[model samples]
Target: MPRTQDFDTAEVVGRARDLFWDKGFEATSIPDLERVTGLNRSSLYNAFTSKRGLFDAAVHDYLDRVVRPRLRILTDEPTRPDAAVRYYRSLAGALASLPDETPGRGCLLLNSAAGFAAHDDTQRSVVDAYQRELSGALTHALRAHDPDASTATLAHRTRLLTSLSVSALLLSRVNRDEAVAVANTAVEQLEEWRRT
Candidate 1:
């Protein structure tokens, strides 16, 4: 008979997610996973199949727990006309609030986009989906913010906002001030649109 699994899977994945966020997949090692997850190599392999498998699960957890929650303002039913503004300001707040070590970690998926996603098809697809989802949510909020905007104008604004948001997340790994500024720039743009 197969043995039942022990330990809290969610907690293990969350720990792994934080490790991966701090260090890219390539930099993360088996010992690192074992240390962070409190599961020996044998148990880790048996549970996740492989380190890559664990990383995949970690990515999923990141999206569900971290990414989606932050996006709630732009995604929840009856999205506010100011949802986009709120979202950008929140991004700025998060970046600005992070401790030195955490800001260097930046975003999990965004960091992966530049690292693993560059060569791995699955990783690329996942990152692309994130980009699409962010852009779509922003577009939805923009429409509510300006109900009479032309299709062309909507497309352009969405593109600009998406770039700014993505750039901020990417920059956080290297420069916290620049990252906060990038995010705040998005907030300024949204506020300007609202006022005009």
Candidate 2:
């Protein structure tokens, strides 16, 4: 007979997500996961199959709980300029709210992508999907501002805005203040784009 899980899967994955976010995938070992998730190696393997499987699940959980909501403002709000401003402002507010001692883990998906091998298709697919979601949101916002924008123009704007978004997150890991400044500049740039 199969053993039943005694612990809450969501709670376990949530803690694991935080651990993976705080420490990059390569740096986070099986022992670290065990400590953080409060599960023995046998239990973890029984639940997740392997360390790679747990990381994948954690990434999915992070995307569902953390990332998608943050990007929802862009998707739901119709006004392009305000939505754009809010997107960056919200990011700044979140970064500022983090305790100074906490390491700015930036985006967990991106952090994992940085260290993953090129041949790692499973992880690569997750990262690609994340980027696509972000790009789609940016494109929607840009199209709202200029309803008649050509496909090429919208694509360019999407790339530009997405770059800024990722850059702000990565920069926050190093310096929250600098990240805020970058976000402000991005907001200003978006406003300028709307003006002309």
lDDT of all predictions, in order shown?
0.90, 0.84
lDDT of 1 by residue, 15-56 (tens): 999999999999999999999999999888899999999999
List TM-score per model, in order: 0.96, 0.93
Candidate 2 lDDT trough over 10 residues, lowest sum: 77-86
Q: Cα deviation of 16 in candidate 1 (Å)?
A: 0.4
- Prediction RMSDs, each to the true structure: 1.3, 1.6
TM-score of 1: 0.96
* Prediction 1 global C-alpha lDDT: 0.90
Candidate 2, residue 163: the lDDT equals: 87
**Model 2, residue 130: C-alpha shift (Å):** 0.9
